[model samples]
Target: MPPYPTGSWMPVALSADLPAGTVMPAQSPAGPVALWRTRSGRAAAFADRCPHRGMRLSHGFVRGETLACIYHGWSYAEAGNCQRIPAHPALTPPDTIRVATQHVEDGGGIIWISVGEPAAGPPRFEGLAPLRSMVAEAGIAALEAAAGTKAAGGLLDYTHDDRAVQLLLAPDGQARTLMHVLVDEDSNPDERIAASRAAEALRRAAEDIARAGIAR
Candidate 1:
């Protein structure tokens, strides 16, 4: 497997994991982010830290369309501009009082965030749909060792019980990886369950390999 690109789209979270009017903490190459979706179903990513008191915005709540910091109740819009300051109800927040945001793409049942300006959108798996996401204590090398194959284009293929499962890998750091399990769109319930369990088993194997200092 090649090294994870520094200026590419990283799959941060599964779309189903972040529903409308919700926020979740996600990892990006740049750092941590608060991935959120509005009531109207628009997805956005912002720097996890609130500018007010540096509180993690992921600890905040989502209003109708804006994310409000739980600390001072400062609400910010989808564009990352501060929209409201609860303490001064009559005052409009200045443009400078805003959180930093990243480019977000919601496609193929995945939420991808760019670390820098990318010339194209995220890669799409045409006939596959996301099953679930899990964090592995191992790195990509261990994953490749466990699966007996390398990941290409951020996707690793694993087969079990004659069923094909795709694993999307995003390196969380030097030692951790975020794994998203994907199966064929036409997969039945049993296939989906098997795929999920296979992924869990793969994760365990990879972590064990990493703990033994075998994957480098």
Candidate 2:
């Protein structure tokens, strides 16, 4: 978890979390993103700010294949080019009006956004299934200290009691981290619930350790 370089894939969200015709705000190493899916079910990420009046584009609406800003109703295509200006429907919007775009990939139950051109694709969890995602108030160092190990290629092996849970961490800003909980694909319902609670406990401990400056 927490790949630091700019030219790599960052797992930003879960595919199930972003439904068709909806937009949500996500963060990347570059900046904030307006992650959205078109009515036709194609996903794309754009700069979160609207070009018209500096409004957050994540507050926009999705119609067909375009995302429209809620403030001025300026719609943009998936490629980040402005497609329509409601105020001047007769005039085609110029190419100059556009938002920044990032390459997005969805697989292994996670949504990945690329800040720069990645040489390869995101890591695939071959034998695990994503349970849920949570925001931890601690950094990666703290999480590693709490888990008693460092992550390997985005997979953090954490042991609770005798059970093992794989945690995938994604960084947000500086002091926070996004934790994606992964369980064995064959885990039972009880095991899954227990794993969730254990992850929460780990988060609390990591946060405490980070606050106390004990994470090294």
Where does candidate 2 stray beyond 4 Å?
214-216
Candidate 2 structure lDDT: 0.88
TM-score of each: 0.94, 0.95
After superposition, the stretches of candidate 1 with alpha carbons farther than 4 Å from their true spots are 1-3, 214-216
> Global lDDT of each model?
0.91, 0.88
Q: Give per-residue CA lDDT, model 2, range 28-143, as digits (tens).
A: 87789999999998899999999999999999999899999999999999999999998899989999999999899988889998758888888788888889999998899889
**Candidate 1 local lDDT, 23-89, one digit each (tens):** 9999888789999999999999999999999999999999999999999999999999999999999
Give candidate 2's total backbone clashes. Answer: 1
